[model samples]
Target chain A: MTLILEYPNTQLKECLIEELQLQCTSWRFAVEANNLSPWNRIPEECANYIKDYMTGKGYQFDLDRVSNEAEIYARSVELKGDGKDAWIFDVDETLLSNLPYYAEHGHGLEIFDCMKFDEWVENGIAPAIKSSLKLYEEVLSLGFKVILLTGRSERHRNITTYNLIKVGFHDWDKLILRNPEDLKKTATLYKSQKRDEMIEEGYRILGNSGDQWSDLLGSSISDRSFKLPNPMYYIP
Target chain B: MTLILEYPNTQLKECLIEELQLQCTSWRFAVEANNLSPWNRIPEECANYIKDYMTGKGYQFDLDRVSNEAEIYARSVELKGDGKDAWIFDVDETLLSNLPYYAEHGHGLEIFDCMKFDEWVENGIAPAIKSSLKLYEEVLSLGFKVILLTGRSERHRNITTYNLIKVGFHDWDKLILRNPEDLKKTATLYKSQKRDEMIEEGYRILGNSGDQWSDLLGSSISDRSFKLPNPMYYIP
Candidate 1:
């Protein structure tokens, strides 16, 4: 009886292990390769942890790290003195934080509330992340022309400009928000095209910084790209 | 002229706001509720961040949290002194973590290499989760019988048994592994049946703990269930 049981168990064990091994291999691929579906929600613990970072010193440290990188790159660039040395900065989360809005509304842990966020935008009370602000000052002193490029619509340009200056940003060579007709373009496409235009206009984009991957992945990517941590959300 | 220029832009802005608002609501439901595709992989950042936790203090804190809950419940239970009072524990990541296996192989961040993992398993060197170990001892002293149920197949019984005892788990009244013939059963179905059998045998399962939701959510569930975090992978 024991032998009969042992015989089948041995065979089954081998098969089961093989199957489990295969399953493990596939799981590795999915995770490492980012092969997940777009519609899937971020896990709750992860979402909350990200929110915590935003509320805590962790977020500032990350911004500081990005700023440090920006400063190093800025210091190394030799200015042409022809208004051709440029740096692109994404507006939301990269310069001004959206923490207060996110803190009340789930910080990307829940679905976005556009009307609510739009109202928050209109309030325009977002404070500058001190690190980014410091970097902004450093770059301007280094003679790198700062160009503000954001996904916010052109309709909000007046308010966006107000907020930028209110938060201590000054003298950006250009502040380019998305045009009404540019709404159809993905952030990457729109931003990439804009960078291409800058290059055509003889401006050398020395560096670009943003909180989203889409902000940095397209054509005319700068000599250096700094990604500030923004686990709150992903923009396509 | 000013009103005409503003009219078209205002109408478009309202239309855009309406569309964006709808998208936001759907995002909230999906994220906060974990309404995601089963087949989808975890987001890469989340996966890597979880791996960071496994190697850092986050995992220990989670294990500590589970143990704390277990201790409070264990202390409150008054066992009837009948060998019938029991607690169930799912083996992997509940008592012994596969973190070491995952750490060397991308911590579930990369594709699972089955043969490599199986080789790791064969080494029988998995260490006990300290928090779970404390809880294991606490319940044993509380006069509740311990039953270990794992999805690992019967063929692995020798090594599995060795690993458990080596990892500070001792004197479990029963250690149940899936039989070769039981390979066709779903984890929920198979485990539920085993739990039913325990019920038939008069085992009063006061508590159960597992890393997988499946391990806790079926027929014959215990009076209370504790879930230890395991973001590395999911079991069907």
Candidate 2:
């Protein structure tokens, strides 16, 4: 009878692990789908799971797949010779990955610290996400005027430009940063306003790529938007 | 040296599996995010993976999590007592599980068959996704008018109604279906047009839940939309 009870106990142990994993998978699905929009922090139970996702092949694979899909969409577009067709790309997770910084910050387990994150950004040592860089080059080759639209403050322009250039990003038609006046705006509104201004100026946004839903949503959203996975932190 | 070579060979075998699994994970992420929209059928290589996903704890976990999140969002909305506030629920995978039929099929490994699917739908024996049924009840209790918006045509109305009723769904304000004229329209356009009509009628769409991006997208997309996971199939 004791051995029988032990057998079930062993199964129970395995069940607990499976349950945690399933829960995190569900959490990630919600996060990626923007169902859990404006989420503040990773759940304590999901910490290790999210850490594994960020540090393991999962992160690289997700990035590769998004870039691959974006490339497919980019290739499908019939580019006009007019050169007014534009591709909007978000700066942070979409192009220059902040993994180096996040690696030190518990892979979203820790609450985000803006001052510390800003310091990391100022360092401008972020590396290019390999697949996204490839897609960037492909988009440029496809005759889409590249637009680097970021929520980074205007003060970060010089270092951001240097960082992007050092990481093989170049020849962007415009790198729009947030002005001090735009500080109060949500990233979604800020991006939409910029895109709106671009549309008013006759720049047709063919594709918009970003890790945040805010970057892809709102008025003047592109013809097609590709969302890259970012389980790290929500920016609402 | 031979032993070391054998060790590396074992590691290589593990790596191959890891690669395949990672690819499938990436594929699922893209699918959920709608980056791989209008995908026809599941990849042949992902057949076993997707089958496991659909049949195992993953599917149930996903359903429960989506319903849980939907419940949270539903509870958040302070619906007007006037009964003009509404919630949109997609039928097929949203409230009813086609797992009975899908179990016979290869869990999306096979190409979607309209005739066979129609026959299955006629049976009206589909089970309720328990979590979604609970969500359906919660939405009803929350003082919001429930709208059943589905891609299912008018032909399937009676059977669909029977299936939903058999599964414990009740008190829906409307069950909008596609007419023969609506057949040419994509699910997105058809659903959007319906939602637009409702909007014009002064109905406030507070929440929308669906397993397909088409259900939640387009012009009049709700105040908040929740996406349930359905890696089994993609509908444009």
Please give, for every candidate in the order listed, the TM-score of chain B alone compared with the true chain B.
0.82, 0.95
DockQ, computed on Cα atoms, for candidate 2 = 0.68
DockQ of each: 0.01, 0.68
User: Which predicted model would earn the best DockQ?
Assistant: 2
| Candidate with maximal lDDT | 2
Each model's Cα RMSD = 24.3, 2.4
lDDT of 1 at A208: 86
Model 1, B110-207: lDDT tens digits are: 76566787788788889999899999999999888999999888877889889989879999999999998778886777888999999999899898
Candidate 1 all-Cα RMSD: 24.3
Predicted chain A of model 1: TM-score relative to the true chain A?
Answer: 0.83
Report the C-alpha displacement of residue A3, candidate 1, in angstroms. 46
lDDT of 2: 0.91
- lDDT per residue, candidate 2, A29-91, as tens digits? 889998885777889899899889988999889988888888999999998869789999999
Candidate 1 pairs with clashing backbones? A24-B112, A25-B112, A28-B110, A28-B111, A28-B112, A29-B111, A110-B28, A111-B27, A111-B28
